[model samples]
Target: MTTQEKRNLIKGLIFISPWIAGFLGFMLYPVVASFYYSLCEYNTLKPALFIGLWNYIDLLTDDIFWKSLWNTVYFALFALPLGQVVAIALAVLLNQRCVGRPIFRAIYFLPSLVPLVALAVIWLWIFNGEYGVLNHFLGWLRLKGPNWLGSTTWSKPALIIASLWTVGGAMIIYLASLQDVPRDLYESAELDGASGWHKFLYITLPLISPIIYFNVIIGVITTLQIFAVPYVMTGGGPARSTLFYTMYLYNNAFSFLRMGYASAMAWIMFVIILGATVIITRVSKSRVYYAGE
Candidate 1:
């Protein structure tokens, strides 16, 4: 290479060196360490003893492991799609031109801006069975409100309901996507004497397909890793009905001093999340609309 070319290459490398170093040190090292730890038996105080696949094998026989896995699956199944759909619906409403629209959007978004722990605490009071607003309102209608966070049958659903509060972030994304839909397409549809429902079904839905795909992947990952709200609200109580996979992993690693086991669980969750993402992306190929496609 010429002298100028060599100097330019060095300068470019120097510009990006900090990012390269950070990725290797913080991201790559931990991923490598965790994978190695997942194959051993280690507590923080002692050396990691090689245990082969025993941790994975033991997970199959442990009831709590299965229960936490089940709870996680239950939470993800409902929370993922429900949150996405609600966010999309809100975005559709918010995208319409109306008086006080910005104020309405801000009001809807305020709940998500609250700290998650504080939000969970507030919802705990709101979901309180005896004197809570929800139950009190139900009583005004001469109806009974179930013991939400206090019942195994209802705790998971309560958490799912609480999950909706954070839909603002997703709604903003959907609203942006909605705005990007071409006005000419809607005009052309109108020329064909299309009704609002027909226009939305044929045009808005297809054009927003890519955004839906993106939000679905995000929702799946977020719901799968859900921890803080349920942790603060129920602490995996009500007969362990809210025992999320991450909460159980935290208990194993920190509370029980089973670092290696927790590492194994983390890797398993990583595989599950990666598999789901791949499946979603592959499925999206047939349905998601892009300008190029």
Candidate 2:
């Protein structure tokens, strides 16, 4: 190679060296090691004994595994779309010029800045069954409130509702993308006698579709890995209504010391996320447009 080409190659490797090192040391090794572990029966004290596909087979018949998967799917199904809509709405509202807009945006984003554990604790207080703020307010209005964390029926919804409080981070991203949309498009639409909603439908939505796609992917991945809130607030209680996939994985790895089983579950999760992301990207290409493309 020429000296200039060698210099470019060296610079490229220098820039990527940290990522390459970290991936090998932290990610690649663990993933490969985990696959081997998944083929064995491992407990912390005992050496892993090769058990072939027994772990995978057992997972198929395991009630807890199925229940955890269902619960996670439920959480994601409800939380992802609901959170995205609310976040986008908040972003749209905040994008407008109004008095104290910055303050309002800050208020909306405040919940996201709170530590996860602290937010969970505060939500626990709000979701408390007997003397909780939510129930008390309902009582004053003479409306009956369902037992949220205490009942199987309401527990998942309560978790979903609590999660909505943190949609501000997503809203901020959407707002930033919304600002980049060309102002002349709206002006041109108005000159052509398009209604406000029509302009939004034709111009604004198309321009922001790329960000929307990104948020959907991010939201799915994050929601699938949900652990802390449900763990802290519900403990997978009320008959495991809130038991997420990650929670189950944690229990098997640490509480039950079934590291091999946990490794299998981790791989399963990775596969699910990867498949969903691929499907979404493929489907979105028709709608999502890049400016220069």
Q: Going through the candidates in order, what is the number of backbone clashes in each?
A: 0, 0
lDDT against the true structure, per candidate, is 0.93, 0.93
Q: What is the lDDT for 96 in model 2?
A: 91
Residue 167 shift from truth in candidate 2, angstroms? 0.7
Error of 2 at 4 (Å): 8.3
Candidate 1: give the clashing pairs: none
Full-model lDDT, candidate 1: 0.93
Instruction: Supply candidate 2's per-residue lDDT for 194.
Output: 99
What digit string (tens of lDDT, one per residue) describes model 2 on residues 1-293? 99999999999999999999999999899889899999989986899999998899999999999999999999999999999999988998999999999999999999999988999999898988787899999999999788889999999999999999899989999999999999998999899999988987888889999999999999999999999988988889878888999999999999999999998898889999999899999999899988878
Tens-digit lDDT string for candidate 1 (1-293): 99999999999999999998999999999899888888899898999999999999988899999999999999999988899889989999998999999999999888889999999999999899976788888899998999999999999999998999999999999999999999999999999999999988899989999989988988888999999999999999988999999999999999999999999999999999999999999988988889775
Every model's TM-score: 0.96, 0.93
lDDT of 2: 0.93
**Candidate 1 C-alpha error for residue 259, in Å:** 0.7
Question: Candidate 1: lDDT of 253?
Answer: 96
- Give each prediction's root-mean-square deviation over alpha carbons: 1.4, 2.1
Instruction: List residue ranges in candidate 1 displaced over 4 A.
Output: 1-3
